[model samples]
Target: MQFENTLSFAKSLDLKDELSDYRSQFHFPKVNNKPVVYFTGNSLGLQPKRTKKFVDEIMADWGDLAVEGHFHASKPWWDYHERLAEPLSHIVGAKKEEVCVMNTLTVNLHLLMVSFYRPTSKRFKILCEEKAFPSDQYMLQSQVRHHGFEPSEALVEVAKRDGEHYWRTEDILAKIEEIGDKLALVLIGGVNYYNGQVFDMQTITRAGKAVGANVGWDLAHAAGNIELELHEWEVDFAAWCSYKYMNSGPGNASGIFVHERHLKNDKLQRFEGWWGTKKDTRFLMKPEFESTHTADSWQLSNPPVLSLAPYLASLEMFDEVGMEKLIKKQKLIVAYLEFVLREIDKETEGSFEIITPADRGCQLSVFLHGQGRKLFDYLMENGVITDWREPNVIRLAPAPFYCSFEDMYRFGQILKSGIER
Candidate 1:
């Protein structure tokens, strides 16, 4: 397990990779007539080769049998959204009835908060990580304001220690105990988008439950990249976009999870639509809303077949290899990336620092001691696809699905040269 910088080390690791062949399954983008290294899957995944054909099938159905496509065509567009529940459930570690694929990530977050974030005089505060993704911050602020509570009074943001880059687990647990009485809900990201730190969902859920709080997760960065047992973890609800590690297309529909314990809980309220009504009598146009007895009761309208088709194709691929196998491979790749990053930092003598945690997921956020923007642009011009965060920090994600060990090594070589110049 010694860290080495030679190309031979990368080749040896690549040869031992079981999922190596899956790299060709994606349509990697090209630059100067060559495939880009594609370290940006943390933002948008590379498209699957089968994505076109998956959408084509639905397009053909719509073209050949316009109206019938809704009810009688192959896969039947009427119940198209239902077909994804099983695969989506498998990915998030939930029962089929407890999960539903619908809406975008932010939209689903808003909808889930509506049902899970009910506050009262005694318990009205929402606990979340400070510097959460902008959308999440906005969502939390608006939700608190909508409930007639001052955001400053109702939102408790957990921040990192003064000089530290990541929040400590002990501090978070202590905060839960300190304010458990006034807390109504805990809504935070499964993997921090900015720093790639993976939060302890199990401990967080346990802490929240002890304090009489409903808990939910925004899994935008964690769903496909890590192993999760949401059902066993007793998470009340969660939602995620599939475009990141899930390899679904950009702006793809997202998935949501609700614990089975809440399936019949009458206290839980939702913004209902006709699509969420009992399917057996949905076409009857009943005036009263009779929600389906599962997570599908949150659906607001019929799914877009084209969007869902690509997700179905991607989820099938996820089901084939399985999450455990994917995560095992990911740990190896990211560990290698971290090792190489450290080597570069040592070579530079404190010119840059890795802000992301060592035990983080695939991403590594590099903070340059000086100007990071120029270094990021230099790397991009040299054909490295790493992203630059504001002020400092270049985020590099050597994704498991398509990235090779050589990609990591090559990135290190280029990064060293970039910073030195």
Candidate 2:
């Protein structure tokens, strides 16, 4: 599709977009009495208009039914999280029984590591990309230390060459092979948060398993933004927050994936809780733990129903449109954004560079060579909502569900003006 850097062309694309109507479902922030051109769904997604309705239903149920709401309400508070499994599973390309909506991302990561990250004297090192999200870095460092291993020795980092912005896939696979018998776990973000590089999870998973290491992904940026086949990829486990591409509210509940191969493994060690007990006998208070034989077995407690409700609102949108359609539109919009940025680069004589890879999802991280926060501040002051990273990167993500091609074009104009000023 040939893209033109004109408002009419952008509007034409918007008119032809199949998912264009989805924008009306969300509430955008206002600036100068008009909706700002929002492009930060990679950080915190805009709230759906239906979110209030979902939350209100839960509130009303509790008000009228009280304790009986556990069993008598429309969704039944006792099994609220279960309602999200099928839809969430579809989003991540996993079996319904293999997915569960519970807990936050890091909490679920720690829980999954308890079962997958079993280190030994010989195979004690865990391999991951350098500069992973700070939370993941902290989690990996503390997990190894919990088992009395020094992080410096137990954590193996695969980094980019001297001045490169992203790690190459071949380099990552080579590191996996280099670590070989000593690599106990292969854990990395599915998409690099800083560079927006989507890793080849299938190849990485196959390589890790062949080398006798457990493989997992943190899909905070990949889950709803990209096409994931976690079960087919043979990933041991994965976790993601719903606040980003999933477009649930701020700090909402997260989704987890455990391949069917591990569901029936009674020998797998996990931090069990009563919520993980079989649903039929869960209320019996049995002394011995009996697993649910599904991914829910990792759930520590009954989920917070209020937080889970917004996801239900968002997942309904995902189920209706499906990932295939969403991804199709995502690629087109991102390509147009790249084109506009390149046009601006030509006008400015290479003032900034796009550091994100071609295989990325919605986000494009723009590195402003020498002009740092001044340009970023100009964008914000002019009502272009984007994210800024410390050294000199600005991140923009035009979410497929809500952002329009017109928004991208407008951003390009604002960016050009900011650069000129």
Candidate 3:
């Protein structure tokens, strides 16, 4: 689709967008009596208008039903997390039984690693991409240390060449082969947080398996932002937070996927909890742990119903729009953003360089050569809500659900002004 760097053209595109009505479902932050051009959905998604209604229903149920709300609430607090499984499965491309909405991302990562990250004297090393999200880095480092191995020996990172901004797929695949049988786990982010580059999870998973390693992905950025086929890709396990592109709200419950192959594997070691026991006999208070042959077996405790209420509201929107339609708009909006950024670059004689690759989702990370934080502050003062990374990168993500083409055009104008001033 050809794009023009004009407000009229932006408005024309917005008029033709089928998903334009979705913008009303969210509440955008305001500045100077108008909604700011929000582009940080990659960090924290705008809250849905229906979130209040969903939470209120839970509150009312608790007020009237009290203890009985566990079984008698409108949605039934006892099995609230189960209601999200089907929709969450569709989003992550997994069987309904294979997906569970449970703990936060890092917590779930540790839980899954307990089962999948089995290290030994012969095959104890873990391979991952360089500069993974800090939380993941910490988790991997600590996990290896807990297993009585030095991180310098147990953790292997595949990095880009000296001058490059993103890792090449061939390089990553080669590293997996290089590590060979010594590699026990292959864990990496599906999308890099700094560069916004989506990894080739399918090829990476296949390569890791070929070398006898259990593969997993941190889908914090990839889950709602890109098309994922975790089950088809044969990924051993994966976890993601709902606060970002999933738009569930701040620090909301996360979703987990365990391939059906692992569901009934009784030999798999995990940190067992009472909530993971078979529901039928769960209340019977049996001392023996009978695992629920599904991803629900990973649950440590009953879910927080209030925290999940917003997620249910957001997942309903995901179900209504569907990922295919959302991705279509995603491409158009991101392409337009790219075009506008290029136009800005040309106008300013290449004032900034976009470090993000073509294989990214909604985000584009811009490296402002010599001009540092001042330009970022300028845009923020003028009401453009973009993300900034230290050194010299500004991250912009025009979420397809609510971000309009006009927002893109205005961002270009604001960016141009900031660059000039």
Candidate 4:
């Protein structure tokens, strides 16, 4: 479908959208006492309006019920963790038994590595992308060093093809074939954080398994922003933070997925904690660790319920919207932004370049030709809020749930002025 420059085209599309009303549910940040054109959801999501109410309910429970809130409340504090699992399962496209929300992203990554990254003499290498997130890189290196293997030698980074903006599927599959036998585990981001490239997790997982290596994903950017099938793809394990598109607030607790295949694999060793114990026998104070058979068995301690209250509210919205529907709208909204931005680029005769691929998610990574930082600063001054990535790139994400066609129009106008200035 093509959109004309005619104003009616944008208005018509907005009128036709079924999920349009959902935008009102969020608390959009303001600049100069007005709502700015926000395109930074890839970094921090706009807060759900209901998040306050969610937190308030729990706060009231804690204050009014005192120590009795654990069992005396309407939604018992004791089972609050269990209430989140069903809604969360739908977000990641997994069964209830396959996912658990606990811990921060990096900590959960380390926990998963402990169980999945068992290195042997011949098969003792970890394969990841060349420029993974700093957190993932640190965890992988530390894990390798712990096993008495040098990071440079034991950790293999499958580099991007020469002169290419992204990692090719065939190149990664070929590398998997070449190193499968010697590989201990494969951990890569479900989406590249900097470039916003959505990786082929299904293909990557299959390729890793063909070589007998366990596959895991860091879905920090991919979780609420993209549709995932962790269980269907047979990913051995995966982890994600909730602050980005999940709208769970800053430094929110994260989640993990473990395939049911590993449920009975007693050979797999996990870092044990009392929270991972079987529910029925957990408080018995038994010496032996009777680990739960599901993904919950990985939990190290009880989670902070106050931090999780927002996720419960946000995930409920996701359950109502459904991932398939959200993705359909996301593709349209992002494509529209690209179309407008590219049309502007064409008008300027290559004043800017969109470094991120057209196939990428809601984010558009743009490189300004000469005045990158100055232009970014000007946009902020003009009430267009975006994030600049170091020396060149500016990331703009037209989040489907809240950002409107008018917001995109306003951003385009501000961006054009910024480029000209």
The C-alpha lDDT values of all candidates are: 0.88, 0.94, 0.94, 0.86
Q: What are the per-residue Cα lDDT tens digits for candidate 3 across 1-421?
A: 7789999999999999999999998998887778999989999999999999999999999999999999999999989999999888888999999999988999999999999999999999999889889999999999999999999999999999899999999998988888899999999999888989999999999999999999999999988889999999999999999999989989988899999999999999999988999999999999888989999999989899999999999999999999999999999999999999999999999899999998999899999977799998898888899999988999999999999999999999999999898
Model 3 error, position 232 (Å)? 0.6
Model 1 vs. true fold: TM: 0.98
Give candidate 3's whole-model lDDT: 0.94
For model 4, residues 188-274, the per-residue Cα lDDT tens digits are: 998888888998899889989989999999999999888898889999999999988888999999999999999877778999899
Tell me the lDDT of model 2 at 247: 85
lDDT of 2 by residue, 1-421 (tens): 7879999999999999999998999999988888999989999999999999999999999999999999999999999999899998898989999999888999999999999999999999999999999999999999999999999999999999898888898998999899999999999999999989999999999999999999999999999999999999999999999999988889989899999999999999999999999999999999999999999999878889999999999999999999999999999999999999999899889999999988799999999988899999999998899999989999999999999999989998999998888
lDDT at position 371, candidate 1: 56
In model 1, what are the clashing residue pairs, if there are any?
Answer: none
Q: Write the per-residue lDDT of candidate 1 for residues 1-421, one digit (tens) a residue.
A: 8969878998899999998998999997766677777788899988989889889999999999999999978889989989889988888899999999888999999998889999998899999999999999999999999999999999999999998888788888888899978999999999998889999999999999998999999999988888789999999999999898888899899999999998887667889888888999999999998878899989989888889999999888988998888888889998898888889889988788888875588787878898568888888887788777887887877778889988888888988898899
For candidate 3, which ten residues in a row score worst on lDDT? 28-37
- Where model 2 places Cα greater than 4 Å from the true spot, the runs are none
Q: Candidate 3, 28: how far from true, in Å?
A: 0.7
